[model samples]
Target: MDTQIGCAIKASNELVKNLHRDGFDRGCIATFNDYMTTFTKNKASLHRSLNGINNAKNGTRLYDSIVDVIQIFRNRGEVSRPWILVVVTDGDDNISSRSLHKCAQETSSLFTTKESNNFLFLVGVGDGVNSEKMNEMASAGNFIYIHAKDFFLLELIFLKIANKITTSLSLSLGNLTVGDHSASWAEVQRHRNLSKVAIDYALLIDVSASMNSRVISSNSVTNLNSVITHATRAIGQSFDSRIINTTNVALLASWIDKKRGNPYNFSDLPFEFKLIHRASRDGFGNDKFHNNCDNKGPTIVVIKVKYSGEIIGGYNPLEWRCVKINEWSTLLPNNHDFYIDQQRRTSKSFIFSLTNQTISRVTLNNDAIIWSRNKGPCFGLQDLCITNNFGKSEQRSYENRIINKKNFEIEEYEVFQVIDKRPRFSIFYFIFMIFMGIFKIIKFIFMRLFLGIYWTCYIVYWIIYWITYWTVITLICVAGIGLIVSILALPIILYLYLEAEIAWVILSALFIYAPILGLIGEYLVI
Candidate 1:
């Protein structure tokens, strides 16, 4: 056997040992190359079968082997316990007669049965393996796919699978210290009496007298409510019109829990706009701003105008940094656009007034944004510059002015880091893209083939035409030379009969005429 197959066998033995140790009662072993065979469920017999795998075959019939195992399970009748089928291979399927799609359909049908508790895992090892096809098959088959760089990692992969199986079967209490657990609400409802059930509860209570006192006055609560309402409206207006519906507004409003007195926690937001910095909670200092917002890419700054209750903010696609003057000057020589006080260019940066429903994008690409240690968030040349808790707005480098006020006091401002929360690839989308890619590849191959044939035929035609022309010219020259020789020989015979020296003259003339006639025929052909 080859070294790779040997290592794989060793790993398989390790997997069997670990699964047996982990309280697994019964399991079967199967091996595949040109043909596949499933050994008896007896642990000792399976071990012997694994040890006896000395002949490493040349072909991998992976799909056919999986189907055979599935057929065996089908023939075994109904299974009372959960069954797992792990298929490990180090190479692509080269000898499988069953198509991948057909095999996938068969595997997926196993889960459609109400009594079926089957789990399939595809483990691919080695660099030469086609991981994409394996993953696709796994997805279509509704199974998990794990990739290992080499056979050495197979033991760990199998151990993980075993652990997953154990965990799925066992009761989970989640993190005990965090006091959070996962339980089906339907299951909880099925219980007869909640009070009769013994449960452990940990309650944190404040013993101080301040806990009994009403710290926030009724007027302050009213103002807080108004601010929250304005902020919620601003958030709703900030997004696209399609997403500004009532459901989204409710989701955005839920970011702040009024009952808990927590203003910023966007864990429930459908999109990823995490509130990273809140001026009221984190403090309204430039140092606090930089500490929370620096190097946190693509932040959205929302400000509530003090008395007017107008909401205005800017979006900075670049990271916010507090560069010292000396440090800034050093970078200036290397990069002309790298400035801490003057400007930073980004076409994506924009200032907006959510209250006015106006979005003003950057007009001057060279001077789109500015960063300063003393400023909170600045855009353009004082288009919207927030210094400490106060800010100013003007129509400088941006397309339109966001606010009419030259200076405004900030009531509340929040900085949120934009996060990419796009969902995972849909199986249908992945399959569609794969088919499109294949079609394009096939089209390109055919185009290249057609061009190659056309050029080949064109070159062959010129070659054959030249060869025919040269053959015709040679035939004409040879016929002319023979005719001159025959005529000169007759005259020489006659001259010999007369015993005259004119025969030598006629022979010399024949040589000269033959050369002249050949040259004339060559010129006429050209």
Candidate 2:
């Protein structure tokens, strides 16, 4: 009854707004706290009056108020419109003069009998709610009982309810068929008419370690906390806008543990990544991570992608690596301000191309495909003008790429070898080496013997020339002194050699010839 009053007023306000949005503003909202107090068609007056219904009320007059509102709508001919009644209370009725049995009978008779024109929904609040009693007050199949413990979730609850009421959305399996049988029995490819454009999606969240952390909010541009918060908020905003028209948006039933926090946990690590083993069993008797959620859709299990830093156990650069059942697939990090899931092999891993500048939005919807949510100007010293437009655009993905079957396996080794190939060396890098090799061949092998012989011949010729010059000088000086003596004795010697006997002349000629020959030979040759 404390915060329940505020939640009730909020819901009522949303319902009226939704009605006006759907072009059916001809309606009235009545708030029943301790008693059925006000009913008005004016939206502003209705909101003001509803806010006046405070937390002071002890008993919720749920039955009496519903009957009164139904009669009012009936009298005003609002029954002709798509009439619906939503009752939000703590499921406690102490002050109502009308008994629970009488209220149930009247609700069934008046609303259920006229099913086409009337509908009743009862929402219970707090832990001590009597669901069976509330169910009895509701019409057979047109009733829904919603329980909420936290008031923050009232906005989401009201929004969900408002979205449903305004759209009047419904799903049917009878009209859906695969081949010759109904879709319920067969694996149908096309569930709806292909001509009509409609997209339905089921959001599967992993109850892993990080999903439960409360995101610490900040205005700092370079803070990691701020980037994560912005990303998560953007993600939530995308979901609200993109999937509203779609039929199915499945949330994990275990996420309905209202005592813990909102279904969408925006907290940080240690507190965030805790797992849920049993839904209904825990230390506290209350259901914090329990399976009592009213959302009736298929529960999907997701394996979270490992971040590059988390994988290497240190401060690593941005890289996205998908988790594998058998082993961890290591991927190289991209050293840029923006991050893209580069190791995509299957069609499901292909998110929107960041290179496409025309695309104003992108989504990390691929399962097992790792992505860096910790990116943006908000996570840096200043904003970067990256091509992807990081924080300035919407990021979203709506395709159910997994359901459509296609397979292509690309080995990481092949991809790394191709993408990480080293650049080729310059052509002129070995120019000096080439020239040196050519010069060495010319000097050592081809010209070696010719150069040696030429040097030896040149040295011997120089030595002979110097020796001849010195010898000529010595001969001139010595011959000058001997010339005088030779001239005086030449006549006598010559006369003796000619006139004397043959033996005496031969001995004298031989001695002179021997000395001349010996001197010339020793000086020139030795």
Candidate 3:
């Protein structure tokens, strides 16, 4: 939905011309066509108001353009049945002759300041756009802009808009229901008809109090999850969970909650760092693991390596550390912009290597992880370029010199997975999860087989304890399942029940937990 503003103007000109040739009333449409032609041809000298701004000869004359467009609405009304005017730039108000404050004040009048899906929709294109200013210019759904790249993407935006205005561009053969709406587009090509992709993801967002108060859009459910999963998969990473394979990835999720002026903090981060209570639950640490992260409790087990290091991650610049989980893991404020030089910072964290101090785009799927959405994680004025060298390092682990923050020195750590016989996080990730899973199995099996008051009750209680552990169990888990056995105090409890030969207690435990413990133990084996 993004294209350069000028490109949009060009698109409008073409569409109107076609409509005029198609025998549609050319009076009001003609007015827009003429204004656009003048703006494009004599752009240097054109003092325009078609874009709702005055003297928009340079970039700043939107006031006049807006006035001109609004005039057409007044004369004809109904805006010729659904036209669009998208502002495709960061509203820096740099090239404008009018001050932003003045433009903002006047622009609010261009469209009815209500959310009734009336008037023109204002879409701020690039990070430079003053969203507030854009909001003032917009009436409702009509005012939206797509951030432009080279002219290619702009052209796509125009085509998409044309399709939207004319007919339904996207159609679902699947069991989707776009009920009681429009039919289909006349000229629409049924290309990009995706039947299936390798990966499918479902993000069960935790909309709890401890988490962000933002809600994922019902409209975007199917597409958003698919897009996000695909985006992650394209980087050879996994989704449906949080795992940072490499810091090189340009990470982004729905930052809409932040855009809606919602709360942001790490306490609300949907995922936790602790290893799962069950062995196999290691972030799906199976061969299917797309990304890599140490399941070890959030510890600063930094490794200094003499070779290439891959495991790299930084707090998302948009995310903040929540309350301290430990000496190592602390809560990050949902808002990192406070310490940032620019309010519109892109990426959750400022990465190194761009001359412009912007978070460098993470290259994946043979395409750089460029952003199309603009919200909490959108780029800022200072973040347009990469901060420093990108791709200088590869993987983090032993077999290669890794810089352990704890030691502040490059050293070796166990290679969980093997890449060139070097300990890379991706491989390490699978190994760690598998190892933990196996350990859990052995523990559960032994606990059930040996500790005999109740095979199910004792094991079930132990597994739940492992899952609910709020304190220091990660370091303990890796050591072995033996520790879990000791920590839960199962043998002692089992002995008490058995010694008492308490018929009521035995029946109570069975009614409550025999099946549960059996399941937990079997789960480990599975």
Candidate 4:
């Protein structure tokens, strides 16, 4: 045993005695059973019973020491710190009148439940110690039976207990709200090429008269072609200016035909003769905006596709002038409308910002301009691949399709605010995930169970419920068809195959399940 621990116990006892309180005070110890035996200090004491039972005061000594400490907070409301009982025993309390179980149970219950008792620590030393009984008296992780012999090791343990009782922890909450003065937003790009394929991008800027004024001066672009040229090169394949001409970039302008004064002719359409913010016949390209600040919010002006013709999901085309600012739309009157016709697409009602806000903005519903090349023949919907700076353009040689060899870091968007948040999908997302996992496991077990004498009753029960209700009826029918086919097909399939006979038979038995199994019709397979 550590010398420091024994000293701490003695010192703690002294400090506890001087404190004044009743209910607020806590600390107690009870030694019991056929294990630890405390010795008396006096040699001249005579036994009242003469058989040593009356004279043995081991239990009394422990009880007195515990009560003296517990009495400090016994009558008061509460104490500032926890009350701990440091129990050091040679072995089990064999000489005590009470059983070890009773001692462990009642003592622990009283001190903790008592207003003064908030914390506890128990230590058992050496061989023959009743560790299980000690565990019952104290919390599992809190109770420890030291492997050393005697009271020598108390210093290290009690000091740790003292440290734990004094520390405090808390959770604090506060964040930005909508309509705050500062409206910031953010965008992300792959730090490295996610794929070695050619990278393509498009920047759609608002060439409206409002955006023509220079940042330093009121001078607007006199030449529309010059603004297009500057923007295309500014946002091309790489940020490095030296290699700008070497890269392949295509560009398109929004309201190009509208500005050209002949909106009806497709020949004089919004698309450009050269690739400036434009896509090829395949529809993959880039858009770089030299003119900054679109006071008009999120809108589609340009688009980008990659490889030969794959337009992967990236940013929303309906952003304000297709610019990446923390807060552009909510602070300004210029947000665009949704695309004309698309499925599974959300209205551009809310913009994602780097910060939160409180006030809503005003805008027109029909003002949204959609720049789509989907109508033209050269614009193959799926075939046109305008590349982004996707790095290596040759990645099809791998045998393992799931492996991504490059270390590509994507830009992470720091959530700005809670605008138009969907609570319905949020609440059930976790539940849906958990249900799918359990369903998969149950299906696996059922498949294995069906291979035995359990096939007929299973098939018969499913037959009844599958036709019972509308919601579940179709599911039952599907499962029934698949199940019946499996049972019938397995036998015939095995008889034809030589090497694969048993294997196909086993494989075919597990194939009779619907996407939603027992839940669909409330199955009964005993």
Give the runs in model 1 whose Cα sits over 4 Å from its true position: 21-24, 34-41, 114-116, 172-526
| Candidate 1 weakest lDDT stretch, 10 residues | 199-208
Q: Rank order by lDDT, top first?
A: 1, 2, 3, 4
Give me the displacement of residue 142 in model 1, in angstroms.
Answer: 1.2
Residues 458-510 of candidate 4 have per-residue lDDT tens digits of 78778776656654666567677766766676656666465566766555444
For candidate 3, lDDT tens digit of each residue in 1-526?
1223343345444433322222222223212112432212222222222233211223434444454455454444443233234333334444335443343334333332221222132323333455544432331112332333233233334344433333221234333212211223223223213311111100001111111112222344554344333222222222121112111111111121222343222223333333221112322222222123222222111111223232232222232121222333346554332222223233322222111112233222112122221111112222211111111233221122122222221222111221122245687798999999999999999887777758778899998888757333543444345445445656656776877768856675565455456555654664
| Candidate 4 Cα errors over 4 Å, as ranges | 1-82, 114-117, 139-151, 168-526
Q: What is the C-alpha lDDT of each candidate?
A: 0.59, 0.35, 0.31, 0.28
Best by TM-score: 1
Report the C-alpha displacement of residue 465, candidate 2, in angstroms.
Answer: 99
* RMSD value for candidate 1: 33.7
Off by over 4 Å in 2: 21-24, 33-41, 115-117, 139-142, 169-526
Per-residue lDDT for 191-230 in model 2, tens only?
2222122211100111112212232323344443332333
Could you report the Cα RMSD, in angstroms, for every candidate shown?
A: 33.7, 27.3, 29.0, 39.9
RMSD of 3: 29.0
Highest lDDT against the true fold, candidate: 1
Candidate 1 lDDT tens digits, 455-498: 99999999999998897788777777776776767776665547
The residue ranges of model 3 lying beyond 4 angstroms of the native Cα positions read 1-12, 21-59, 63-76, 86-92, 95-160, 169-252, 256-433, 445-526
